[model samples]
Target: MKKKPTITAQTKQNLIDAFWELYCAKRIEKITIKEITTRAGYNRSTFYEYFTDVYDVLEQMENTLISKLKELPMQQLSSPGDPFPFEALVSMYSHHSKYLVVLLGDHGDPAFQGKVKASMKPMIKEILVSQGAKDGFELDYTLEYALSAMIGILSYWFNQEKGPSIENLMELITELSSEGVMRKLIG
Candidate 1:
């Protein structure tokens, strides 16, 4: 679908950027749309044009993140495989670690996390199918199961003060899944 040129996109993006800046200097609960628009140099209507509230903006941010991560060709990924993309993703996350920490902090919505999980199901199924797991192999059930597992691991990595390096984590996931159940369908 071709996106028509409009102020909505710009306003939404500006709001998101504003939220990021404010989120750094203040807590998410303390922030307001007034502050977001002011920081973003937009007006109230512009802010309304984008998101309903601070949490709404946060939802948009999470969706953006999931989409970004989803862009990665993550199916069939294994140890001793490509390093560049995984490294790039980790680097990006590390760069924005503060943003993520604040947005997904203790008070964040479980439903927001659920949205991310729901969103990634199709992508996970794609990876599974490409790796020789049938496209319809228990479909939604397996997709959700695998995606939930991946999300759980990623959340642990994201929350920790120190954890396995991305390279290590990538290899870890591959080893855990690839050789055990994942190899069964292919062989």
Candidate 2:
């Protein structure tokens, strides 16, 4: 009798790590399953046992990140007079900066960013409404602006070698977010 393929969490993580490494080194189109398995120290059968293709692996990675972000204490930021929950936010990104840098790099996936925005918008909207933003065009504009600026700042931080300290980054986010860019510009 033939043995069934046993997929373990370790093996899946190895594959993900290996895939990220290869993806960092080259474009996704240039990466092959053979390379992924070889780097992961697994064979073809083992690689296929968990993921159907490279895109599937990428999607899984993106979903895993999204899930982590969703689990953060977003409700804490909703209250009035609360300090900006910067530590929690920055730590989560810095901890996973390796995979994130790759995704936000020159060869990054725009689709992944889109998915991230979609997943995060609702939480941000709730936070804003709780902080007294009215449900109107202003709310929509604020959501759009906040999400875009966040993605841009994160991408910059991940890519730069001497980016601001996490605390500084948090301060920058808080200041700019509270003080509108136009206000700073017009001053």
Best-matching candidate per TM-score: 2
Q: Tens digits of per-residue lDDT for model 2 on 1-187?
A: 6553464878888998899888888888999999999999999899998899999999999999999988878777544533234566677778888887778667888787778778777876676566665667766665666666787788788788898787788788877865773232222
lDDT of 1 by residue, 23-96 (tens): 76766789988898888998888788667888888777887777776666555343222212344445555666
Indicate the worst ten consecutive residues by lDDT in candidate 2: 178-187
For residue 49, give model 2's deviation from the true position in Å. 1.3
Tell me the whole-model lDDT of each prediction, alpha carbons only: 0.65, 0.76
Residue pairs clashing in model 2 are: none
Q: Residue 165 CA error for candidate 1 (Å)?
A: 2.7
